[model samples]
Structure formats: C-alpha cells, structure tokens
Target: MKRLCTATLLLTMLLSSGCENRPKQYERTQELFGTFVSARIFASDEKTAEAALDAAFRRAAELEQTFSPTIADSELNAVNAAAFSQETAVSEEFSELLGLSLRYSQLSGGAFDCSIGQLIDLWDIGTEQATIPTDEELHRTIHPAAHEVISLQDRSVRFTDERVRLHFGAIAKGYIADEMKEVLQAHGIESGTLSLGGNILTLGCKNEDEPWVIGITDPFAPQEITATLEVRDLSVVTSGRYERYFEENGVTYHHILDPWTGLPSDAGLASATIISQSSVQCDALSTAVFVLGAQEGLALIEGLDGAECVLITDDGTLLQSSGMDAYHVKQVEK
Candidate 1:
C-alpha cells in the first residue's frame, strides 16, 4: 500500500486577466497512482496548458503500471517473481530509479529501502488484511544495503533471497511528479503547482511577486493546518502516522514500517516534512525521517545540500533545519 502525504496546497488565489500580457492559471486533475494527480499551470494559452496536462497524466499512469508491486503483470512484480531465482532484466528507467533509491537507502542508513515488499505484505498496512506483526517474520524479510542482497550489473537485477522484493510505494509518486514537471516544462509551462498525493512541487514563483504557499496538515486536527511554507521551484513532502493506519485492539499501527525492526516506527514524531528540489527526495525522506525521529533526521538533512526539513514531534515540538531561515516558514497558531 502507498503512504499518505501531509502537505497540501494553500494557494487559492487565481489571476484571470483580459490582458494578453498576463498569464492565467489552468488546472486539470485525475485519479492516478492511488491518489488525485492534479496539474496546474500559469500559461497564456489554454491549448498549450491542456496538452501539457494530458501528457503529464499519461506519464503518471504509465509509471504506475511500471512500478506498482500490486499489479501482477507490472515490471516490479516481474522482478519480484524472477529476481529471486535468476538475473532479470529491467527497463532503463527502472534501473535508473532503483539505483537512485539505493543511494537514498545508503544515505539514510537503511532507513529507506526499495526492497521492502515482503514485510509490507506481511503487515499489509492500509489494507483489510492489515494486522499487528511481531518479530517472527522480520528475519524472513530483506533489508540489505544497496549491493548486499541485489546485484545490478548491466541493468539486470538478482536478489540474494527469495523473500526479497522491491516496492516503490515510498518513492514512485514523487518521481512521477518530477517527471510531470519536466513534461510541463517541455511544453512551455513555467509557473504552476503540482499535488500528486501530497508531493507538492512549485514551478517558478507566483507572478514573480510571491512564492507558492504550501500548508502542512495538522496531524492532531485534519481540518486544520500546523504550518505553511513559502517556496518556489521546490518540492515539499510530509510523512506521518496521521493517516494510512489500522487499529488492532486498542493500539494503532501506522503504515510507516521501520525495515530494521519490521514494525510500525516508534520514532515519536507525529510527522516529518522534507522540502527540496526533487519531489522524489521529498517523498522518500519523509518516510525515512519519520523512522529516524528528530535528532538523526535533522542531521541527515543538514548534511545534504539543497534540502531542509520541518519536523513535528509527537509532543508538539516543532523542529527545523539550520537553513530554515532561508525560506518564509510560518507556524500557524492554534
């Protein structure tokens, strides 16, 4: 199952001008990748905007089929089915994405893994089959480093264990969102907002006057917000236990699984948001930092260039990266 995002768009003002010199907003949304995929643009012509939006949505659907582990005939599923027994060939795009994900996994020290499908199925969070899991099957699953269990020589993949499977749920949508942005940029759309299931990416500034405003959802109150970030040409992604969970008995189990423990993360954070140029990084880091908690997570962000994060702890402590002052980040008063 896919994780949820806590970042929402707060920009509601649209400029509709009769002047041909001014750009106007055009938006088109569709349900894809198990979430609402919307593409908005500030283009001078509707024809250009519509074509770009169509291309973006089409690319998203194609990627879903390529990456979805649940799809029995998907490339990911094919790899899962064959990689255990023999070296399997993957598409060039899949190979590139897998290598990048492995780097993130290494950077996070196994906090983020693409090879997490087996444990996901065992716990089945966000599904009817979800159940509280113990450490009984933890060893049966794989949480290896980049090259520990899998070999990727010549764009072919082979898993060391039969139980090892790849799941892109934590990163695919964000990658797709980035690709969407590229497609829009190619179509001559410069300014817009993209919300692919809470992976928010802004294309340029709003008329060069202000940056796009992104509202971080309130984990305590879904209808309210906790903070807002003013950013441009950046991706903002948040991950938390606020959604995508199942309650068993009296305890709640979230979908954010810690690969090391094979259990729901106990990092003691309500949510963690990552703001960066790559929505793909924002997507994976959100889950990674949630498992990392505040201290280590903040340090990780600081070490990486062009990245900043805001973490909302379980006890209502708001933590920020050292470079947070670079942006106009505001904490919404309760």
Candidate 2:
C-alpha cells in the first residue's frame, strides 16, 4: 500500500507552458491527517501560496490518514481487519468511498477490484521479496473469488469472505485529486490545477487565456513527455508500469496486476491515460485498461460514452480513442 501523505507540498507542475495569468495567492496546506497542516495558496507574495498549500496539504493528509490502509490506527484498516461489527456503524464518508470502490468492481468486471491486497503482498512487487508466488499461495491470498462475495446494502458494505483483501492504491490518488479540486472550488478558486502524485484535475481554464496543459509521461523514459493534453474542468488519470517495479534477473515486474491470473498483465500497452468527468471512474478505468491490455482495453474505451483514452503500447505504438483525438498530444523535446 502507498504511504499516507501528510500536509506537504511537492511541485507537481512542469514546463509551465508560459502563461502570465497564474494564481497569485495559490496556497497549499500540509498535514499528517488533519493535524499540524501547513497551507500555501498562491498570491502576489510567494509566501501566500505556500501557506495555502500548507493548509490544503494538512486537510488532505487528515483525510488520507483516516482512510489509509497502511495506518494501523486508521478507520479504513479497522474495517478491513473487521474491527467493527455492524457496517452501518462506520463513518458515512468511509461508507460512501467503499460503495464507490464496490461499484467500480462490478462495473469493471473485477478488473479494478480493491481486494487484491493479498496478492500484492505475496509478490511484494517493490520489495526484495519480489517474485511470483506459488499457485496455492496466490489463490489463498489474492481476492475477488467471486462477485457474489461482496455485498453492499444501504450505504454499508461487507466482504463475506475473510481471506479477501482490498487495496485502493490503484484508484486512491485520482480520487484524492478530484477531492482536492472540490476543495479548491469551495474556496472560490476555480482556475487552477490540483495534482496528487501524477493524477491531475484541472479546475477551470487558466484565467480564460488557455486550457490547462497536462502531460503524459513517457513510459520508456521517465523525464520525457510523450504527449500533452489541453483541457479545463476535467480530470486526467494515467496508469503505467514504468515508474514502480522490480527487476529479477532478466524479467521486469511492475505493480499493475491481472486479477484473473494473480500476475502482472502483458496487455500489449505500456500505459493507458483516461479522461472523464469523474476522477473516481478515471482511477478505476486506468486500472481496468491496464489489466485489459491493448485490444480489449481499447474496445472498453470505445464502448463508453463521454469517456476518452490514449493508450501507448510496449512497442512504441500510440493509439487514441475516437472521441479522445482532440487531446492527442505532441511530444515535447526535453
């Protein structure tokens, strides 16, 4: 699982695309789960933005901590550990998030299951223990034995099976990005980008001068930008096996795993970036496409309305869904 972010501001923007109308008081807040938050919002004085960012980070950190699986004391971990008897007694926010995850599980046909924690632990993808697990071990730990195992009723959830594990690492960042955007909107700052890690949400156009430009990182080369998308009021999520992985001998193993096989999927594509109204869906879809690989993933993109995708294959082939052609990007030379 990913570490819960405290109120810290990391520079998420690159190659600014040259605009005079940037936010003056853009502030960011930092917190380790709501307490001790540092906020920095941009203003004429750089300190203003820094202060706002600090506050925003703190608020985000609070939420992350509350929902974090890695946090031993978090409510999320408690639920997973069966710390609570009745699902209805859980917090509404947690319940809603769980509901969203379950819906995505059904919608993606288990491709975006949140219950693959056990399988991830087995492979230990980023650790020294990284290696394929035995069939028995894999079967015993990896989750979603059957869709019928998960039940949601009246804003509450229960995983009928005890062995089933859940991991929101696949979709949490995008959801956080969306959540941050909402926070910015509530603050009446409608024209800035909120990016968590690499998941991005463009709130409004940059001062009506230009659409926010978001970059798609080159899967083969980390520092390079394979494409740039211009958009406003939209969320963009990209999933790739490039950054996080472990290489054993001659083989490379990345984090994205196929639920069906309990192994990394060789889905012809190195990366899949999706654009949609909901960051939650974007998060789930990116994982689903990564699992679906190229052909079927592309078909899934085509099947959805108001959804667009750009898929880059392992062989350097870049394909865009029909409606997504407008966001097709030009490689910017570093």
Candidate 3:
C-alpha cells in the first residue's frame, strides 16, 4: 500500500542520470509477514549485496516465525496457549517484545493494546470471513486490562485471566524492520532502504547530500499523496483505517478497534503517520495516535523528543505536529 510520490521519483531519476558514481542499487522483494517486504542496498558489487540482502530477509523470516500469532509453534502462540493455566517461560526476545508492548499499552491509557487477539479473531477484518461481530460477541471477547492480566518476570510471561490473548500485529513489523536494518549494517551497508509493507526505514541518507523522500498517502484517495517528507536515517510508519476494512449494509468498518469500546475506532481521523528514529516506536505510536485522534495524538507526538506526526482527519484536513515542519517539504494540493 506504500507509494513513491512524484517528488521522490523525480529525485531518483535525477540522481541516477547525473551521478556517475552512484553505487549499484540492488533490491530484493518478497512476501513476508503477510505483506510485501523489500530491501534495497547500494553496494559496489552484486555478490556482497545479494548476500547482505539474503541475511536481512532471513532475519525477517526468523522474527516472523517467533512472533506470528497464527503460526502454530511461535513463542507468542506458546505463551497464549499455556499462560491461560500457568506461567509460561518465553525466549528473552519474546519477553522483551511483550514488555515493550505492555509499556505502550499503559502509555496510551489502553488506547493501544497487544491483548486484543480475541477481538481481532472475532472481527476478522482482512480475511475472507470478515464480518461485524455482534454486541454480545464483542462484550464477551474484549479485555482492556492487559496491563493487569499480563505479567513479565525474568523473561517469563504469566496471565491472570484465562482468556487473555497476545497479538503483536501492530508493532511486530516495525520491530522486524529494525532488525533487518541491523543486519544490513552488520554487513557494512551504510545506505539502504527497508520497506516492510508500509513501514519504511532509511539507513542513512539517500546519498551524501539528499535525504530519502517519503510519501504520505492520502487516506481519502489512496492513489494520491497528501504530502512528502525529506528525511534521513528515520522510520516512517503510518496506520490508517483505509488499510483494511469491510463494508456491509452501507456501513464501513475498519480494523483499528478501540480497546475500551471493542469496536473500530472512529476517532475523527482517517490516518496517523509517525516519524521516529525507531521503527518500533513509530509503529506503536501510529496506532496509538490513530486511537487518540488529532488533539491528543498531536500532543503525544510533541511530548516525545524524537517523534513527529501527520494526522489526516476523516474530513480530509491535514494536521502536523510542531516538530514536523523540519521534515515537511511541500503539501500536495487537492
């Protein structure tokens, strides 16, 4: 669902035409985590570049195996399956991710939660059986007490409620993207791009002087862009109701469910895009901000030191955080 805007396309063309010393750009794209994941490297040779890209993809696949909720033997599934009865010992990485998810859930005052797997299954927004769950079904499945039910102790997870389920879909892609960047860097890659679906991270600048240009999608018109950002060594993660939804009886339902209401959040905003140094934070905060809406979401981004946000309301109005001015290039006119 990510698109390269006109500005970025033009920049890439210009760079390629004018710069004779532009390192060979090698790219690998594959299906991972149920989405298109790609890695582009600027390397001097093909063999080294392919090896590094392979490592990055392998790391992504490994992380997906560990975290995917639907995967039968994932550590997350193990915790969900066993913690209903007793404490579940998880890998250090699994515990760390769970701890981080819990922290974000608390930080957002339950606006963003990882313990919404039951509700997700009930709604099934993106699958073929996607449908609206009844009030009774939602009431029975929704559990907003993730912080209280889940406990992390010595890399182990315990659940007080037998029904508690863990879902990291909101933040797992960003975490995996960060790990891929690390793998690329470990292979001496100084400049590259990792696009795990819509979560985009640029490793260093596009070149010595130009920053990577990221297109902010127009939620109302998915084919167009609302704005473009010039950034370097940053992560841009966007969460939008338009990304996944289903229509029934003239009413449209989105995938972003509010933990408190156990329904798709109608927070007066269509999308929330976050720019941060850490892709994981950007991913978590984008969902949090979408749930928080414009006023509170902007406030949250402003309070964070290395975070900025772009919020597009349901009415098509665009709003940006105070710190976003530095990266904002030019807004596209409707």
**What are the lDDT scores of the predictions, listed in order?**
0.85, 0.71, 0.88
Residues 1-334, model 2: lDDT tens digits:
1332322222223334454455664534333432332222334445544444555555577668767766889766776777223453467666666678877677677788787777887888766778878889877776553344666675566777776665677776666666666665555555666666667777667656577788999999977889898876778889999857988788888889888888887778899999987887788899899888888888887888877888899997888888875664666665
List TM-score per model, in order. Answer: 0.92, 0.83, 0.92
Residue runs of model 1 more than 4 Å from their true location after superposition: 1-18
Model 1 C-alpha lDDT per residue in residues 11-114, reported as the tens digit of each score:
22222334566787898889886788887899888888889888888888898899987777999988888898888999987997888788788899989888
Give each model's clash number. Answer: 0, 53, 0
Q: After superposition, how far is residue 315 of candidate 2 from its true place, in Å?
A: 0.7
- Supply the TM-score for candidate 1: 0.92
Give the TM-score ranking, best first.
3, 1, 2
Give the local distance difference test score of model 2. Answer: 0.71
Question: Highest lDDT, which number?
Answer: 3
Flag clash pairs in model 1. Answer: none
Q: Report RMSD (Å) for each prediction in the order shown.
A: 9.7, 10.6, 7.9
* Tens-place lDDT digits, model 3, residues 72-104: 988788878888788778887788778888888
